[model samples]
Target: MSLLFSEEEFQSAWTELDEPQLDGGWELFTESMGVKIYRLYDQDTGLYEYKVFGVLDSCPPELCADVYMDLDYRKQWDGYVKELHQDQFEGRPAVYWQVKYPFPLSNRDYVYVRERRDLDLDGRRIWVILAHSSPETPCAERSGVLRVRQYRQSVAMETDGARGAKVFMRYFDNPGGMIPAWLVNWAAKSGVPNFLTDMQKACSNYAAYCQRK
Candidate 1:
């Protein structure tokens, strides 16, 4: 049902459990908050693609997936989100997100299409979400914001019986403009674990949020 990926690609997402490396060059990057991060350098772009594996010990798999896809709730919890909305582009669902950067840095934005799938693999449940930057520019360019042209992301969450869920996430996006390597590296080291921590809190508050809605 994804306009961006074929059925084979959808099914192949589950294979991340066994083979996390789709490309052959991932190296151990860091580990924090019980999460292990791996980085793969792209010689073509001089950017690093990151793959992360971790367990959300308290949040349920479905809750984690829902929290991730809930754009409205995201605005309430994610402080970096300046503007976000969903749209239809070329008959496919697309999302436009404007993110606020630290002072002295210009804000960055993205226009991408995303899809989510819930699969029952021999009675085991899996949630997969894939997002890619649209090939063609779908929306008008903003005046002061830099638009990121290359981005790719995928997440696979597998339930672990009564424990919780095991999560695998891979993503890369070139934040347009000249960004310091140290800044990017620091974000990778600290940003992911911080996001996961916030997400877990958001998951715990989701039921209450929905009730208020």
Candidate 2:
């Protein structure tokens, strides 16, 4: 199948994150270390779509964007990534990822297409990355893992002076099983912050990593 979405979809995502309002069923989920996470519940799926806006202090937009797109380097830093690799199906590039989950819960995997864009809007440079699962994928589900059939994520970043960036992200995925609401809520409240913290450390070490490679 073709890539799940197009450029217009990514543009729309950037616009939505550019100016997020609290009144649009988006409630504040958490705020810490200059980042704020928000969530909007979907009545139809009984799931939550999360949005995050924040300043990545002392991290340049270019570096942040590059780090996000550097799949080969991602495994060196991101522990949650059990398996990640790129593939070509029908002449289109697709990414296959297996993510680790907490004990007692099965691991989850995804097959998606991703794109990166650089835009200049209103004289401001913005970097965007978009990803969504394909409808009819060639990847088969693993025996002990669940496939996240419905998954999507978008991120936008812009310079916030010489050494910082204003970052925004939207994330959602159906884990595809009987998962408890409380567990999901707890994961968000804690996981997001931890992820950001790790990313910052990774960014700081990126230059040396590149030098070694």
For candidate 1, give the lDDT.
0.85
| Candidate 2, 68-182: lDDT as tens digits | 8888889999999999999987776789999999888999999998888888888878888888887576777789998889889998888877688888888887787889766
Ten-residue stretch with the least lDDT total in model 1: 14-23
TM-score, candidate 2, is 0.92
Residue-level lDDT for 79 in candidate 2 = 93
Q: Which residues of candidate 1, in runs, are more than 4 Å off? A: 89-92
Tell me the whole-model lDDT of each prediction, alpha carbons only. Answer: 0.85, 0.85
Q: For residues 1-213, what per-residue lDDT tens digits would candidate 1 score against the true structure?
A: 555777777666667865776458888888987889998887766778898888888888999999999999999999999999898866657899999998889899999888889999888889998888875846878898999899998888987666677888888988868896656766878888888899999999999999999
Q: What is the TM-score of each candidate against the true structure?
A: 0.93, 0.92
| Candidate 2, superposed: residue stretches over 4 Å from native | 1-4
